[model samples]
Target: MNRTARLYALVEELRAAAPRPLTVARLAARFEVATRTVQRDLQALMAAGLPVRAATGRGGGWSIDPRTTLPPVRFTAQEAAALTVALAATDHGAPYAAAARTAAQKLAAVLPAATAATARDLAHRAAVEHALATGTVLRLHYADAAGRSSERLVEPAGLLTAGGHWYLIAWCRTRRAGRGFRLDRITGADPTPEPAGPHDLAALLRGSAAAGARPPAALAALDELTAPGELDEHRTTGT
Candidate 1:
């Protein structure tokens, strides 16, 4: 297991083993990392709404509420393909490299026939144009270009491939913003639970562009492909 997956596994294990709240030192001992690293991990977990708590003083550590439920894990073939492409695009030897490759293997094992074929064709024909993917969960202490210091507990939503680059759209708690954060700028990320509130564009904008207006030429061509099945829904949704 890579560092990213190891951290995730550790969190899951600790959450399972502890009867009460755990301290930074205890968690550090469990992972054999510095106290500072455990503290940072705790912040990311808390932001991700893991029901984590921290007490001050010598006895302080991290603790998750026993009542809290684990997050769900499900993905469609297209979603899996997107993730595979995104992972392949990351720096050649990132910390999550081994885990991501393994995930892509698992995705291939589970994909439906037609969907898998489409993904294979796409993967073979198109290269990962940008290398990004900082980590599974960000380190929680980095500042953005705007000089804003922020921490986020983000669920890896679907990966998007557009104009030859990959983007991760997730539910971010710290900014309370469902924003498309560039994977490359991410200093580090760890797998975590999805936050309660999701960022939905339809819900956020509330009809910003004005319906029935003729779309630009680029979007006009999408109508031809809306013959039947789920494709029709995509057209109806103004995709």
Candidate 2:
């Protein structure tokens, strides 16, 4: 499990064993992680203002006050998907970019195992979107349509998804106009602190609108990517 989910699970574990502390050894065994890792996770939870208490000395462990945490809520598969995607959107071009991802992870932590797995999988779309949202120039090692490679700096303008793929719409400084770089073909991407100069996203979208570029085949792929409980079933039931 990722650290985000593990932190939540750790709390639940401590809560279940409330009134009795579970030693670092036990907690580590329970989570299948090293004891030192559990210590770091506990420290993180405490930093986040969780009411986590660590008992010291021999026979001591960790526990949380039951009154401090909220009760659980059930989420349907569609709701989980929507929340995951929406939180990812907030990570882009929003004031709460960091908090947004944290919230998404916390939301997944509270979900059922199957649902949480699906939500986490979809939330990874943020991994690509994040590079575009830095509002700065980016160093990208990219391969083009014919698989030729080049390294260039780009000013991110926007991003779009279709055909189960994400395209970074940017003003290619070399081209002096907008170009779409498919995310998968972008072997490496690093956002620079240097702020990007103003560029118009509309310029890119205009050509796409004229081309009717996200054609039927691409739209079909989009439908499959977001088709309700299909993801839940596929991940959980393997059907």
Candidate 3:
């Protein structure tokens, strides 16, 4: 499990065992992680404002404060359906797909039967097409701006939709850099058994934004070729 989900599961486990301490060793065994990792996860939970209490001596463990009570979480059927549909939009082959599916199931299990049925139906109808699954290693047949084509092995970082087009941001092994490819220009993609490495997603988005702020070469050339008076006239006339 990922850290976020593990932290949540830890909290639920502690909540279930409230007033009774669960030892670090027990938590480690339960989660199949190192004892030190459980300690770090507890610390993170504490930092996030969870009322987690720790005891250090023999027979001592962690517990949530019994006096603290949380209100029941409530969601409307429409809201539940929307959330399920959103999860269904994730790439089927992505690393997060299993997690997303598990979460959807958990959500359905918590809701009313009728609402759960509606959510399942809505999720079934939603799909994300022609996109590389996130966190997958892909071999792509890519066509570039000048109509040149090349094959590249890339680790998909994420997907973006802008101006009615979809793009894949990936760490390209061929170029040894992060690159964005239009989905339409990628003629083919096949998943590789090798897992993808982590990416600096924020930096990639920033670079994409910066690149987008500049006009295309043809537009720039047009601007340069136009006389000042003609440009002013065109703007004034709304042409």
Candidate closest to the true structure, highest lDDT? 2
Could you arrange the candidates by lDDT from highest to lowest?
2, 3, 1
Off by over 4 Å in 2: 1-10, 24-53, 65-68, 91-97, 106-166, 173-177, 183-239
Q: What's model 1's lDDT at 25? A: 72
User: Each model's RMSD to truth, in Å?
Assistant: 16.6, 11.0, 17.0
lDDT of 1 by residue, 39-100 (tens): 77677656645567776776555666666645435777679777755653444346776666
Candidates in order have lDDT scores of 0.47, 0.64, 0.62
Instruction: Residues 172-204, candidate 2: write the lDDT tens digits.
Output: 777666667766666655445577877765544
Residue 180 of model 3: what lDDT?
70
Scanning candidate 3 in windows of ten residues, the lowest lDDT window is: 230-239
Q: Report clashes for each candidate as comma-separated counts.
A: 10, 0, 0
* Number of the predicted model whose TM-score against the real structure is largest: 2
Please report the TM-score between candidate 2 and the true structure.
0.46
Off by over 4 Å in 1: 57-59, 71-239
Better of 1 and 2 by lDDT: 2
1-239: candidate 3 lDDT, tens digit per residue: 97756876888888889889999999999999999999999997776556898988887999988467463356686887777767655565678876676566656655667877666544532331222333557777767655677887877665554445555666778777777776656654554557688875435444234233222332222222222211111111111
